[model samples]
Target: MEQQIDSLFNWLDETTSIIEQEENTPYIEALIAASNLLFEQQVPEDLEPNYRTQLTNQVNAIQFSDFEREARQKAMQLAILKGMKGATQQHHYITPETIGVFIGYLITKFVGGQNSYRLFDPASGSGNLLLTILNQQQNMEVDSYGSEVDPTLIRLAFNNTNLQEREIEYFHQDSLKPILLEPVDVIASDLPVGYYPDDDTASSYELKAEEGHSFAHHLFIEQSIKYTKEAGYLFFVVPSFLFESEQKDQLQSYLKEHVHIVGVLELPKSMFQNEKFSRSILILQKKGPQTRDPRKVMLAQLPSFKDVEATNNVITQIDQWFKNDR
Candidate 1:
């Protein structure tokens, strides 16, 4: 599998380099290369004839169908990670595969047995995390949707899912703005953290700041909650200081009114470069006639993922809690 992923990534890198010679940025080159890989044809008519021919020859050498879905996804992830390295934006980070798999496991715990359910990721960057979750739920039917504001990322996302042969409805716009989506059974996001720039849009949110710009992460939480069905679950990768900031009181009040806190699992500290930058997975269930608060909110400090036995033990405990408590 590793070799397969490497081969696919090498092809992407080479193709991207070829496209880069046309004076495009690494990000654009990668997106173009990936799209060409997905369609198994060169889509750019504007490329120099020589570069176009080289890309065509490279594309013809590999059978994309020969790679497993996981291999293809991982290869694309590598290509995107490389592209992001050259990007100027600080928030172009891709979710680590381990974290994506962890979130996918949690989602499966709640909805795996259902016949079908709708899932949405409002901050689905490059569709990596959302696709990771979808890969885990292959046994069941899922209506998946992802919204991303970045044009480059959304195009990469479309190409990624298309190559994986997974169907997802995508919305390209500010997720904090009014979305025309029906409430979903589950909402998951590695919430974008920062102050929202648009005061007009921020004014409409319950978590909007009274004196200044609202925290984008705070507004994302509210927006996600608004698009979640009653009794549905929300899993967010939230900053460690989420409830310790100046606006904690208002955010807490809003959460208390709309949802029941189900769990807060602190991710392994080793996963982050600094303690202050670490995040936790916040689990909440939207209040509904059928929903009740758990006897105790699930809380745990997860061990380093490298400690396989410890990680497995924690997962077992989580499974037992879900089976016997909720």
Candidate 2:
């Protein structure tokens, strides 16, 4: 499986390099290569004939149908990670696989018994995290939806899911703006942390800052809560200091009124280069008759992912808390 993933990624890399020779950006090159893999035919029309032939030959050599779902997903993830590294845009970073897998495990614990449910990711960049969760929950039917404002990322997302043969309805617009979507049962996202530039749109959010641009992550929390069903679950990858900024009071007040805190699991500090850039997974449930604040909020610092035994121990503790305490 590892060898297949590496080979598939190598093909993608070679094709992307060929396309890059035509002066396309890294993101576009990846998109083109992935699209060709999905459709089994080259899609770009303006490349030099030799380059087009080379891309087509590379596509012909691989039998994408032979790769397993997880293998294909991992290969595409590597391809996207490469593009992200070359991208100048700060928001292009792909959610790490470890984080995606951990979020999937948590979601499965809560929703695994359901026959079917809807899930949404408002800040779904290239569809990696959303698809990762979906891939992990193959036993249950999931109606997935995603929204993104960046054209390139959205295009890449469409291709990514299409290649995996996963169905998802996507909204290509600013997630903060009003979206025509039905409320979902589960919401998961690696919330983009920063100030939202559109003050006018921020104006409509209850969590909007009293002055100046509002924190985008805060607004995303408000938006996710708004589109969630009664008692639905929300898992967010947020900065460690989410509630320590200048806008903490307002955010805390808003959360207090709208949702029950389920838990906050601080990610391993070793995963990040600096403590200031560290993050945590925040678990919350929308306020409803079926929901109540956990008797004891689940809080713990995760050990480095490299420490397999310690990580599993923490996971076992989390499992027990859900089974016996919460």
Candidate 3:
């Protein structure tokens, strides 16, 4: 499974490398189609006619290999990580595997007993959360889906998770909008934080939109929960202000009526370290009337900064909390 995943990333690197050199080539669509073919063995039938032609014109150039692919993919991922300076500009905040894996572990504990499940990330930048979730559930079958507003990151994410037999879907659209698919069992993401132009369509998120300013992270949390099935879980990495500031009260009240606050883990101040952002993980469960309990919540603070062992211990502690509930 790992080798196949590596090969998919290699395809991403190769396609992106080609598109970078041919900036005027309109290769993004073709690259995406080619990747679909490489892993899924077919292009999506809904692709436009022009995109199909563009793909046909470039498909032959995509080479495949059994041995060299893994190393090449790693090189490509590293290159993008180091060279894609615009990643942050595009709101592509990559979650560290350490944190992501811990979240995945908790999510696994919550939903692991099921025979199968669907896990989604509303703002799945670069597909790290979905990939991490898959890593934690090596023995379980999971259908992974995500949506991103940036087309470039969407392509990168689609490329990263397009494993041979894995079910993965990447949508290049705003996650604040409703997804047409059925509600998922688990929704987890490092919610993008910042104020952007208020999306008119997001008027439904009453508390999230005010006058001309809209806080994106709040909206995503609402949207994520909207698509989460009853009793489904949601895990999000959000700015600390969501818990500390006056702005949080409205959303908090809204959540109290809709979902159960599973826990709020305040990360160490150094969690974002050099990034100038303080973050916390907020866990929630979509509740039916019978399951709603506003007081049933846990609050935890991570250990001292730079202590990996202590961090792991905190992760284990949280994992056990969820385990006890099960």
Candidate 3 clashes between residue pairs 3 or more apart in a chain or in different chains: none
Residue-level lDDT tens digits of model 2 in 43-120 = 467767887677768777877778888888898888887777767776888898889888999999988679999999
Question: Which parts of model 3 have CA positions greater than 4 angstroms off?
Answer: 1-76, 86-90, 163-165, 274-276, 292-296, 303-308, 323-326
lDDT of each: 0.88, 0.87, 0.69
Pairs clashing in candidate 1? none
| lDDT by residue (tens digit), candidate 3, 1-326 | 46655654565656555544544443444344445555554444665686555545455545444424334334334544644644448474567666776787778767766878898898887776677667778677788888888887787677656532346888888777767678999998998887756567657786655566677777888888889999888999888778665567878888887888878888777665554577788989899755755444667887754687987787677666655643
TM-score of every candidate: 0.96, 0.95, 0.75
Instruction: Give me candidate 2's TM-score against the actual structure.
Output: 0.95
User: What is the clash count of model 1?
Assistant: 0
Candidate 2 runs further than 4 Å off: 27-30, 42-48
In terms of lDDT, the poorest run of 10 residues in model 3 is 67-76
Pick the TM-score winner. 1
List model 1 lDDT by residue over 275-314, tens digit each.
Answer: 9899999999999998898887888899999999999999
Better of 2 and 3 by TM-score: 2
